[model samples]
Target: MSGDASHRPLDLRSDTVTRPDETMRAAMAAAEVGDDILDGDPTVRALEEKAAEILGTEATLWVPSGTMGNLIALTVHLRPGDRFLAPALAHVVEFELGGWASFAGGVPHALPWSAGPGRVSPASVRASVPPSQPYDALRDRLLCLENTHNAAGGTVTGPGEHRAVTATAKEAGLLVHLDGARIWNAAVSLDVQPAELTWGVDSVLACLSKGLCAPMGSVLGGSAEFVRAARRLRKMVGGAVRQGGVMAAAGLVALSRIELLRNDHSNARVLASGLRDLGWEAASPETNIVLARVTDAERRVSELHRMGILATTISGAVRFVTHADLSEKDIQEVIWRISSMSP
Candidate 1:
């Protein structure tokens, strides 16, 4: 954050931009590793156990990305003709490449909640399925919920809301999976453990890289048998890793930095308030992501980069993400840069 501060680009592009610091690198270098495929890597096992403990699941498996983790959960829950349900704008359906249909052979059914875009009520979820169906019918079978929903401006689904939806799914005999890639942010913002928001769900996935600042990997946690099946599915999808403890050592450090996420949430709120003060309408972020209304978002993002303030164009708005790598000085610099811009 010092020395040539003016030359540094305010990279509010995404949390994924963060690079591992010295402590993480040191852990990675000092990791005890082995062939993870044949003989499991000791550090990877430790990290997986830590992830399971954090998520309050029976077991956990380390995977390559959030997409693969979610996909594995999907394929494990639904079959070829089964119907899967999720919020209309969920990353699993929108961002991930039709993996349910492509890999799992399941069909997708989008259900939007009455409260807003990223929520679904018990009644609504119940209504999405049939009251009575014939034996020949292939009915809705799975539900996936995204906390701190990406396209919905990172809005959180509290434990109550999460339970409301999941309760309905349970009544309908439907399995549930949580796309909790940003659950750490939600937990920090809500002042609750991540496991509290995930109760009753069959499976859950959280990323180690985003906001957590690990260079790579995501962890999927669920019942012991669910994780065992996921491991085979992971291997089938070419996500297997040997000597993975090297990267997992960084994840071990990432878990230790959970409390630090509050800073990103704080920075996000500050950035949102600053944008509003400067006349751009920005959503007050509940977590680390800020979605702001801007004229010509593509042009604004380009100009922001020109001014050394980096962002992304999302849903016709300029998206600014706060991360562990961004310091308070960086936030102020970004605000100054934005205030100086015409857009």
Candidate 2:
């Protein structure tokens, strides 16, 4: 980032910063809500049903955020002291403040990213399980996978690998949970149904706020029995709501526009390519995140901030994320400004 270094506002931090559009705001205002915890919110139920159908699950529960949804799945799948495996730098292990351990009472195991960036091999999943022991052993009970993995520059896990790894976990008597916070991006990038990436998982969570432009909410889907248990866990974790339909309304609108993420993916590639041409080591992104390796992360980030371009660091790389909020022209302008920055 060298040259003029002039201020030109653009935010490439995370897709979660996307704001609801007018249609979503109107839907939220008009949404028919009820006491979700006491009785039930009709709009919330509608969002849950739509999410379950999209994810190919028996049922769904709307939660306040993807983190809570993942935690609920973890608590439902594991007993205290049980172990769960996830890919290295998975949000479940690294980003969620250790709730899997502190709240779900499960031990965490990180599998290497041998399959690819943000992907774990089926062999690794099998190898992670402990063999029978003479004395008490740490039970490996769950395998968690992330789609459009965050720290890996939003790298995607394809449907075939998804099925293979989930099958391996099942064979090893381990339940599968997918932290699909950005599954919408994976589905669009792979040209596959979201369910294709989630097949065979005991539980899967998808975020409404990420790339969907919803204000907030995530849907957790699974077998009816599993969701029945998750509902109890949700309340236990203080995730239950009263008038959640306001948020669910925006989620409904967001789902209707999921195809829009294709533009974000396109913009991300353009940003990475542009940055690379400007002497930055920007990785070619698989989805909407570009991880550019730079000399001084903190200093370069501060420089980017001075130019009014926001970004965050992940795995020692500067990460720039594209979302519905940004257009191709905006991305080009961002690159132009970076190119204009002083050396």
In order, candidate lDDTs are 0.90, 0.91
lDDT of 1 by residue, 9-67 (tens): 88988899999999999999999999999989999999999999999999999998999
Instruction: Quote model 2's TM-score.
Output: 0.96
RMSD per candidate (Å) reads 1.9, 2.0
- Give me the runs in candidate 1 sitting further than 4 Å from their true place: 1-7, 134-137
Task: Write one digit per residue (lDDT tens) for candidate 2, span 68-140.
Answer: 9999999999999998899999999999998988888999999999899999999898788855644577888
lDDT of residue 99 for candidate 1: 89
- For every model shown, the clashing-pair count is 0, 6
Pairs in clash, predicted candidate 1 = none
Error of 1 at 136 (Å): 5.4
